[model samples]
Target: MESWLEKRWARPLYLAFVFCLALGLLQAIKLYLRRQRLLRELRHFPAPPTHWFYGHQKLLQDGKMEKLEEFVEKYPCAFPCWVGPFQAFFYVYDPDYAKTFLSRTDPKSKFLYKFLMPCLGKGLVSLDGPEWFQHRHLVTPAFSFNTLKSYVDVMTQSVNIMLGKWEEICGTRDTGVEVFEHISLMTLDILLKCAFSQETNCQINSNHDTYVKAMFDSSKITFYHLYSFLHHHDIIFKFSPEGHRLQEISEVLQQYAEKVIRDRKKSLKDIKNQDNAQKKNYPDFLDILLSAQAENCDSFSDTDLQSEVNTFILAGHDTTAGGISWLLYHLALNPEHQEKCRDEIRSILGDGSSITWDQLSEMSYTTMCIKESLRLAPPIQSISRELSKPITFPDGHSLPAGITVVLSIWGLHHNPAIWEEPKVFDPLRFSLENSDQRHSYSFLPFSAGPRDCIGQHFAMVELKVAIALILLHFKVTPDPTRPLIFLPQVILKPQNGVHLYLKKLSK
Candidate 1:
């Protein structure tokens, strides 16, 4: 009786194990077939030798950009880069190919961008089709020339605060200061003042501000999530430690945005007149978003408002910080160009005490240097889009619908086919004569076409103001010991911080 009972239990357990093994094997076979199909479809585009299982994963480990550049050199216009056995994207660096893809209305890649939804929600960065168009229209006025002009004084004040901190640091630190950390805080300060009209004193206290800490931490975590395949699924990531931390950060950010919105709404109610409120004070980015909601109650939900606010806070501050940091790095590396920029700024503003909107345009040489820096170290290294329909490139190579394509801005900027001695820092490359001769899509630091950065104007203005003020107050020189190793995260960041020695200039 005991033996019979044992056999009965063992037979059922064995059968269940076999069933599960078969199911798993079937799933594996299905994925393998899908990989084979993708390989066949992308056979036309030549790619570097990739392992059957690992694909190009090993090659991209330590120095991703260096490996990418090697591939860029080998391939004429575009090439296929596989992330895994079942995934690949066409990395297009050529101007003509870039134009072909950017000009289209392809939706952003869902697989890549969906991870951002938890933090960003359905903000402009992730929206598509009619919803995207509507949001873009509503937000465009917030960045108008007149609106941006009003923020110059606020920007100057923010820059002054940062400069004051640097002045304090220069007195004690002879070893050189890491500018990226300081600049990141300054940009965040500026964004808060300009976006919500709240002064967080992030640049001064730095460590005491929870919101600022959350914002920076959130950016790092978001970048991690983008690359971590194991944490890609929503259910799995939500339960993980990193995911829990991200949730905490998101809550802090959202609560802050909500509070700002509530306060602003209450103030608007007291005014009782939208136009009068606008006439009294320049409407901030948040005000513009609120006004849009007032005009169309059906659209721009509360969630949408908060999402846009969070998006601006994240995208605005971080990207600008990276751009400014790299610009300083380039200027430090090339003193001649730096001096030229200083001379031009000195001629415009004697002490660089203040910068007006009109004066920003007058810094022509400085603008060229800024453009050159952007070309070399674009804040956004690459942007991907999922093709809504079959599309053919200028080279006659085509990708079918549903395929993802990555427009490599870094590759384009550094492509030897586009620019001569692309690695060398040459501001004259952006001169009017040379710029006119280049392809329209060849140099796209802000990206090109319909889906370009909405805050490009705002960013340029802030960059000019900060660079001018800093250059006036001190002479910047690169720290030779801390060489920059480019780490392409969500924003292009230096693996080692951007350290520069500052010598205070005589007033």
Candidate 2:
């Protein structure tokens, strides 16, 4: 009887051991597949020597723009970057290399994007394979040229609202306003109205907006987790404090998006009750998604709808906010370019408060200034991809399938060989004559590929409208007291708020 009792306990313990052994073997196989697929043939390819065990972990952890610049200067095109012993990533800055890689049907980096998964949940930004293709195809028409044109009035109204608030705030005080604090909220408010046809009045309450705080908090955490070796493991990360915080913030963000989806879905059902005639006539992005879902269930589900919309809400707000904030700073720094852009806007609008769809086309100088700013401080400084097939580049270099590829849009834009005095805020470089002389892939602010930003047209239009209105009413000048420091966030943004002095202009 004693023997039987002892044997019973041993049986359960043996089962547990077996289970663990199986799991461990499975994980080992996965790691082997990942490493073997990304062959170390490219390990000997040009790169700074590693620390043997940690590889380039220390260098990457303390990584800055200087590191990126040095590498680009030395290699000029493509070079390997080892994040750790396991990670063998390749960095490509050459336009030709960029063009070639972009042309391929490579997927987004699986390892790096895991951080975004809890928040984004397989959204357009993180999606890959056939799923990504279908989602991109569905959303492409939502940002069509005609659709973007239709949004002009909504964009105008959103900008006008922001400017009106700015007028009151800047009326008596000579003290300049922080550009990011104002611009980010304005963009969020505009995104809601444009995407789901919901005016969130985000600017009014943005200071206390939990969603905004959560998003920015999550973004910083993501950057931190990017370099942390332990955070890469899902099992360990989930038990950590950062992971707990990510979960809490993700719930807040997801709930907020759920509310947006629910409200819009209900409003569409009772379309006749919508009091605003203008808003009633046009179908917003949500409406299009809903229509598609009803027609074909397989194409888009409720989960997919929420993910895509939330992706846009997060992406559409912050990236544009960062881009515009930097754009304003650049314009403020270069008063000459600011005046030229203002002159172009005035010639087109001519004291008219409304920025018509047709007038936007005439503001060529303004567009140039915007493009130059994007080049100087591209919101998304770099993008990473993973190859599905082995490929050879035009430069006689080849990399195996499944390796991580970092496309340094920031590096390419700032490359001295590709650009003349790249640091200078010279909008003239983007002039039709000059721009044509430059390589196609040299200036990839929107990225260049089948997977390029879907809302590129929308973002450009929104930027033009905002800049036109802001410049028309106030001349932006850099705050003499506060200097800005750029940091590589989820998007490239100034470390602190962007401070700019705005002198209201008389018509």
**Judged by TM-score, which candidate is best?**
1
Alpha carbon deviation, residue 221, candidate 2 (Å): 2.1
Give the CA lDDT, 0 to 100, for residue 369 in model 1. 95
Q: What does candidate 1's lDDT look like per residue over 281-375, in tens digits?
A: 56688988988998977988998899998888888988999999999999999999999999999999999776888999999999999999999
Error of 2 at 413 (Å): 0.6
Clash numbers, per candidate: 0, 0
**Pairs that collide, model 1:** none
Candidate 2 regions off by >4 Å?
1-39, 49-63, 272-281
User: What lDDT is reached at residue 200 by model 2?
Assistant: 63
In model 1, the number of clashes is 0
TM-score of the candidate numbered 1?
A: 0.95
Scored by lDDT, model 2 comes in at 0.82
